[model samples]
Target: MIKTIIFDFGNVFINLDINGALQHVRDTFKIDTLSDEMTAFNSLYEQGLISTDEFLEFYTENFPKLSKEELVDVWSFMLKDFPEHRLRFLKQLKSTSKYKLILLSNTNELHITWIKKHIPFYSDFKNCFDAFYLSHEINLVKPNPNIYKFVLNQNTLTANECLFIDDNADNIDTAKSLGIKTWRIDIESEDVTNLFNVKTNLF
Candidate 1:
């Protein structure tokens, strides 16, 4: 019956250029790709295994040439802008009271802090969700079965009764494996502006 709608926050709400961040760092720092250590540390960073200060320190110490601000800039480059129309759509959906709306995002503390600072209506958008789960805060990131299981357990939602929407195909596949219905949306084609079409009874 789809009693709940679990949404991925990145492309679903705010625009994120995942490639942009990598490119930004590569070009600016003269680096070809992420280092093996950085790649390994990222998993821990995303899961909140390390504190924010520890993350910033790791980069700052390794790249002495790059200033703290510049490191933050490259790290934060994936974030672009949040459109106004999407916020309105969420507001409309919240008013409907048809389904339990939850946001599950694989994001870190620094990016989240940046979002709140940049987006004027950040609080309003968050208010629309029945639950807003962040990977760093929850110590669980998506594409892992445990994170999906955590949400299901926390909300007491059965897999069959929830629909998961994510821009990442891997994340969608993981959700589907757990018996949840999923929409692996293309960020370009899927305008969440027409969310009502995807959902029924959201009056």
Candidate 2:
């Protein structure tokens, strides 16, 4: 039986326009592509290998023309609204008391700060989950077997007893490799509201 339900944060809980952000950064910064150094830096940031300040400093040092505020805007442009209806759905699910709800998100500090500011019902949404895991906070990222193992080991949950939901196909594939049941959701048109149709607690 499924005893835990794992949810992805971006594109799942809050809407993220990855293409929009990339385009915005390119247009705003007049950059055609991310530098190899920047790419490696981002990987480390996502892996929580460096502090937020260090990440921002790396960008600021490389692109000194852009102010920190402008850089923050570019970093956060992909984050959009977290609708209340979704919050209500999660809240109702929380009341079910049938399965443990957990949130696993690959996000950075700048984006999270934006969420805390813009998403009015953020706390309510967070409260619905028994565990809230962020990549930056945990120093581990999705699609990595170690992170999934970390969650399983920490929660004492077997892979067969957990349902991992993520919009990223690679992440879903990784979870499935660990024997975790998964739903590769489409975030733009479909939302977690579809979870209502899922019969939980079934082996």
Candidate 1 segments exceeding 4 Å error:
198-203
Per model, how many backbone clashes are there?
0, 0
Task: Name the candidate that leads on lDDT.
Answer: 1
> Per-residue lDDT for 6-27 in model 1, tens only?
9998998899998878888889
Give per-model TM-scores: 0.95, 0.94
Predicted model with the maximum TM-score: 1
lDDT of 2 by residue, 103-162 (tens): 998987877888889888888888898889999899999898999999999899999989
